[model samples]
Target: MKSLLSLLLASLLSVFSLPGLAQTPEAQSLLASVLALKPNAERGEAEFVAQACSACHRKDGSGKSAGNTPRLSGQHGAVIIKQVLDIRSGLRHNPPMQPRVTEQSLSLQTLADIAAHLQALPISGTIAKGPGSGVARGKELFAKDCAGCHGANGQGNQATFVPMVAAQHYGYSLRELEFIRDGKRGNSNRAMASLIKTYDQDDLLALADYMAQLPAPQRK
Candidate 1:
């Protein structure tokens, strides 16, 4: 009985202690800067195209391949700003994205605009299918482990800057999940890493498929 109580207390603490559940100082600063300027979705669209974001993310911000690059459509502007800052600051180690941050000569305003444009776009589209067997298992795992942070509908919690994962490409989601699970990605949340460690390759694929099949909620 003592052990059971201890375990429950530990679990509760873990939930509250997850990183990025609140905005960091850097993230808060970035959000302030972006908000200080008026976001122009039109300018953001031009900047996104000029930066060749469309090449990988597609013109609509829907990702190109399954389980690979994530769909950015309908993602919150604040989330986009935070990720851009993370990649720039090396908190997130995405090699391809690093150059865009450090060498691309894009200003903070451009980044803010791009984020606004992406957020304004709707996340409607067809997603690639995953193996049939793993989808059900994935749903179960997501409900048990992912939903608390990502939301029941996978819409993500904007207040915390969690990216929306619903209707994303399966291949992209799978690759990222693998990276986070394997500890290959930097700036990953410890709670997510711990949860993902229990999953095998098959489990990752299943979870990806389930998330990919989830419908995107209407933007408020």
Candidate 2:
């Protein structure tokens, strides 16, 4: 009986533990469109504020609230481009962001420009730290489960379009992890979903807080 239960658990774990899937055709097209244009970072910055992105993300893209809005500062241009496209296409569901991106009538060039400006911003800002939550346990889990793809320092791999997770808002990051774990997020990564499923709410909270305190990805 014990062997059977353990086998079942292992199988379930494997189901969620698959590697990241190949990039979608839509992602490829978005990348191609961004590369085809010459973006103006200055203009992009202006538009980002004018478009009300700063309302939730802050003028610097550091997120207005922890675990609710994400820190976009110093994130890779490729990752930002992919996420924006996903939101626009309804591959990712963000009600507040959807109308903003669509109603603004932003063109591909404009999108790329915004991405460029965001990438140029420094990744320094105030983020909420979880007090006496689960720092030690979170650090251990992060190194074991998260460091491989997100980097030892959470810098994220631009080539793979992984967003930098360090210094992100604790609340927002926790929300995203919960959403992915529950299969609520549309652009969910299967591997992450599976891994997150193993953690309880406290575990996720600890992880988010730990990540929020890490240094932001350094500029090249």
**How does each model score on TM-score?**
0.84, 0.85
Clash list (residue pairs), candidate 1:
66-171, 66-172, 67-170, 67-171, 67-172, 67-173, 68-171, 68-172
Model 2 weakest 10-residue run by lDDT: 4-13
Alpha-carbon runs more than 4 Å astray in model 1? 1-28
Model 2 off-target regions past 4 Å? Answer: 1-19, 22-24
Write the residue-wise lDDT of candidate 1 on 1-220 in tens digits: 4442244334333433556334465555564566556678999999999998898889989877745578899997767876787788777879888888762577888987998899999886667767767888999999999999899999986556677888888888888899898887777777788889999888898998899888888866
RMSD of candidate 1 to the truth, in angstroms, is 8.2
lDDT of 1 at 171: 84
Error of 2 at 58 (Å): 1.7
lDDT of 2 by residue, 1-220 (tens): 4442244334333432345544555555555566557779999999898777888888987875636688898998767877887788787878778877772577788888898899999876787666646878889889999998899999997656677888887778888988988887888777778899999988898888788888876676
